[model samples]
Target: MIDEQKQQDSMNNEPNQDQQTESSESLEKETAAATPQETEVVAEQDSVPEVETQSVSEDDNSQQQSTDTTSTEELQAEIQNLKQKLEQEAQQRETVTAQAKRLAADFENFRRRSEAQKEEIKQNEKRETLTKILEIVDNFERARSQIKPETEGEKNIHKSYQGLYKQLVESLKSLGVSKMRPEGEPFDPYYHEAMMREPSNEYPEGTVIEELRAGYMIGDSVLRHAMVKVAAAPESSGEEENGESEKNNSEEELA
Candidate 1:
């Protein structure tokens, strides 16, 4: 019995050894196949990462170029806007300058016109006042010519009056007033008023034979016209006498 049991144990142990060997050989074959497939997957993964890195780099370069283009366009627009604003400012400045110059010219013209009007008014008033004063001077001159002084008191008064008249004439002379001597001068309608006409052998026709009233001048202007007598051709008395004699002879023949 001991030998049989030993033989049986030996047989069991031999079969177990053969199964263990077969299982180990199969596991080795599967491991070999899986190893190659795993290597292939790892290689594909590596190649994928390289492609993705190249695409990302290209995208970054394109984004940088687009950003540069956008920035350049913005700068050009800003430059154009600034140029338009500068043109508008220049036009405004020119308009304001023109308005200022025109206003200055208008003001200058108004000032000159106002000054001229004021001067004309002042001259008119001065002439009116001087004309009234000339009337008083005429009265004084008439009084001096008409009054005669015989007594000592009368002579003294007359002398004082004459002195006053001379002083007044001197004052008028200093004020640009001057007397006109129309006697013996040609009669001018502008400066002389013909008060009377007289036949005179001493003066030629159209000549002033006598000054009835004194004329006056202020500067080159006639202040008062001279009242004058203009000379005319004398009528022939011999012609009038011969006409009368011829009339008497005709009347005697008719009788």
Candidate 2:
């Protein structure tokens, strides 16, 4: 009975040892598969970080390009505005210069016209003064003609006076002075001054009877009026007798 019990115990112990060995081998195989899967997840996470970094860099580059474009546009607008301002200033300068030139031209023309007018006035005044002097020279000629040439010395004096008179006339003519004596012309109050009134049978009423001093004019300006005698109608003999009776009688005597 003891020998049989020993053999049964040995057989039970061998089966238990083999079962423990099989359980240990199965656990090792499961651990090896889990380690490989964990390694693949770690590698995928690393690759995702690289992709995010690249995306951030690309965004920074795009923002910088937009900023550069904006700056360029602002510079262009400033340049355009400055160009317009310069053009406007140039145009204003041109207008001012043109106005100044026109004013200068007008002033020059006015100055020239004023000078011409002054010269014309001076010439007219000179002509009128010379006309008055010519009448005085005519009186000298008449006085010389009335003098008698009796002796050689008188003849020589007369010749000398005549020569001097002719020389004076020639000198006056050289200065644009000339005589103006209108005969058989109607009497004018502007040119003629009546010195005396006379009854003339030959001339009509309001006619010039005689010119005592000749008139003179220079360029339509009268220098001296002619001292003249005017004609009037002849008085009747009956009118002269009536004038004598009126002078001698008083008002009481006539009543």
Candidate 3:
């Protein structure tokens, strides 16, 4: 009875021991699986620096690209500024050209006006000089016509007068002055002032019979009119006697 009891007890204890051992082996297997998972997590953590480095490189490349874009925009802005400046300069050049042309035209006008003024002054001076010379010529002509022929020096005076007259005429010709004598010519109201009318058998009616004063022209312009006597138609014998009696009666009344 004691041996059987010992055997039973020993068999029960053996089962308990086997159960404990199996439980321990299962716990160890679960622990091992959890350990491998932890190792994998650690390895992933170790590779984090490489990923960070790659990300940093990408960020740097992006920053460089952004900087390049900013530089390109600045260059384009500079080109635009240069183009505007050039356009302004061209406009200024055109304005200056127009102003220069206006100034040149004004200068030309001034030159022409000045030349005209100078020419007018010269013509006035020449006209004054000629007028003074004409007065002297008139004096010479009166002296010669009134000289006495009986005087001993009259011949010499006449020769001197002729010489002076020739010289004077030559000088007047050079100065564009010409004498106009209208004796025995047709009546011209423009150049002649009729001081007397006379009946004449030798000339037609209204013919210039005599010139009391000679006319003159200077450069196509009349300087003086001719004092003239015009002829009238001849009167009949009875009309002439009547006219003479009236002229004598007027003369006797004035006396």
Candidate 4:
């Protein structure tokens, strides 16, 4: 009976050992499959970091391109502004130059006109003064002509006077001085001063009958006025004679 009990116990002990061995082998296979899956997940995560870095690089490149474009546009705008400013300055310079030229031309014209006016005034004053001096010379001539030398000493003095008078007349003639003869011409207030008026049938009214004092002229200007006589209008004597004849006829008819 003891031998049979030992065999049965040995048989039950063998089945329990086989069940423990199967559980241990299945646990090892599950551990091996889970380890390979973890390794694959770790590799994928490492590659994701590379893709993020590439995306960041692309964003930086786009930002740099935009910055360069903006800088170029700014430079162009500044260049255009400078060009416009230069044009405006050039226009202003031209305008100022034109105005300066016109001013210079006007001043030149004014200077020429002033010089001409002054010269004309100086010439007129000189002519007027010379005319007055000629009147004194004329008096000397009249005095010399009326005198007649009788003795030797009077003849010597008259000779000296005549020489001086001739010299004075010649000197005045050299300076464009000329004598004026207004006789028998029309009476003019500017060139002649009428001293007396006489009724004469030989001349018309307002006519210069005779010249009293000799006048002088320089160019077109009258240096001295001529002293002259004017003529008076003549009345008709036939009208008075006709009136007397008519009165006498009327008295005879009444008788």
Best by TM-score: 1
Summing lDDT over every window of 10 consecutive residues in candidate 2, give the lowest-scoring window. 246-255
TM-score of 3: 0.56
Question: Which tens-of-lDDT digit does each residue in 107-225 have in candidate 1?
Answer: 99999999999988987777777778788788888988899889999999999988888888898888888989998999899999887776667889889877877889888988888
lDDT of each residue in 49-118, candidate 2, tens digit only: 9999999889999999999999999999999999999999999999999999999999999999999999
TM-score of 2: 0.55
Give the better candidate number (1 or 2) by TM-score.
1
What is the Cα root-mean-square deviation between model 1 and the actual structure? 9.0
The numbered model that scores best in lDDT is: 1
What would the per-residue lDDT of candidate 4 be over residues 120-203, giving only the tens digit for each residue?
A: 899988887897788788788678778878999999998898898888878888887888989899999999888877656799
As a TM-score, model 1 comes out at: 0.66
Off by over 4 Å in 4: 1-61, 148-159, 235-255
- The local distance difference test score of each candidate is 0.85, 0.75, 0.83, 0.83
User: Least lDDT summed over 10 consecutive residues: which range in candidate 4?
Assistant: 246-255
Each candidate: RMSD: 9.0, 10.7, 10.2, 11.9
CA shift of 120, model 2, Å: 5.2
Clash pairs detected, candidate 2: none
**Considering only N, C-alpha and C atoms within 3 Å, which residue pairs clash in candidate 4?**
none
> Clashing residue pairs, candidate 1?
none
TM values, all candidates: 0.66, 0.55, 0.56, 0.61
Instruction: Compare candidates 1 and 4 on TM-score and give the better one.
Output: 1
